[model samples]
Target: MLKVQEIRELIKLIDQSTIDEFTYEHEGEKIKMKKQILTAQAQTTLVQAPVETSPPALQKNTAQVEIQPGAQQHTEVAAPQVEEQRGENLAEVKSPMVGTFYHASSPDAEPFVKVGSKISADSTVCIVEAMKLFNEIEAEVSGEIMEILVKDGQLVEYGQPLFLVKE
Candidate 1:
């Protein structure tokens, strides 16, 4: 559990720190956090694991996003590999709620997609976990993965860009 001040401080750190993962605990509560950077977008995730009965963040499938401080900032990113996709920017796929984003269905598994991977409109691009429920994230448009906006296991905000795909 986190106090209001602690949450505020965490937000400040989130904004300033380039590191993607953060964790803190007190008393009987334990928290695990992770962040990642692909393109310019960011993603984050927070998990509470107690000493007993470690909650399965996702038992079926797990997406891991690691946000590190040294990761490149999206806004400051350069378009080095997107020469073919020039003149048109990648489409942004953002989160609809606050939760964890997973690239794979489970831990020790391959991600759903990789950079330059072609995705279709009905593709199951990723997963977002909220309140113990895992939600499937689909690509609304078809394109090539230009940039991964967020990291795996990242905690994402509502309407935050998750991936940038070039059409």
Candidate 2:
């Protein structure tokens, strides 16, 4: 089995090379990767919803999104902007794979981490359910949990930031 760091290194290598696809299998574990080229305009699909209030200033934003390739999902543009305003001192704990994020192991259980909670690199921050498999996500960075980006049971995409930690 390959470690996350190893997989990340492999991705960097594959991305830098001219190779469009790569696959590897070992010990019943299989990994496959592919790259797709998209034009700048086609890469983003922005949607602006009608304003509910009579005033434009009242609404936070008209609504804008940057759609990912192969996934038509659109997220609020303000989230990232808010993240940026929070400052660069914060480190993001991103999702390794697309799945439903769960702060706790079960609905009735207490969450793994919360705002102001201190965490080590090995601490379990949350769980993501993908294909019925519950995968535990680590904090990976030693810091205090500053923000929770997604709600429990919300569907998250690959590489999407889940939590922000202040180191």
Candidate 3:
């Protein structure tokens, strides 16, 4: 279990980072947070409900609540699109958890696998560090790495594609 302060800090970090969602589990307690954007219709519903209850008092407040269409836009971020363009069969190695992706065991060491490097099913392709724990991510499929979708030290979310492999 995480403390309240720790959870607050985690939320703050997620808000500041580019990650869309975060999930953490410890001893059976799991916490997940996702960034949400309110649609224009939803925002209007939220503001209109309170104004209808109090007419005079919230008359000034209603004027201040302006619902601008396409003002606060929400753009969907696309996941890595490292599909095989050569028509060869390809497999994706996705991240299992949300964390900082590391290409090597250490800062000075070489990357575990690069483009054109052949890997087996159980090969350790990368590491994801979450809350001081280093998790070894496996290839899960035998193939040659065709493209690395993420850069070193990049923050990745769960189910995000890390590499495209030619199977």
lDDT of 3 by residue, 1-167 (tens): 45433553454456556776776666655556566543222222232112221111111111112222333212222122222233558888887666899999999999999999999999999999977999999998898999999999998765577998898
Provide TM-scores for the models. Answer: 0.49, 0.55, 0.51
lDDT of 2: 0.63
Which candidate number would show the highest TM-score if scored against the true structure? 2
Query: What's the lDDT of the predicted structure labeled candidate 3?
Result: 0.63
Candidate 2, residues 15-52, lDDT tens digits: the string is: 55677667776765555656554322222233332211
What is the alpha-carbon RMSD of candidate 1 to the true structure?
A: 14.3
- Please say which candidate is ahead in lDDT: 1 or 3: 3
Over 4 Å off, model 1: 1-87
lDDT of 2 at 78: 17
Q: Model 2 misses residue 129 by how many Å? A: 0.2
Score each candidate by Cα lDDT.
Answer: 0.57, 0.63, 0.63
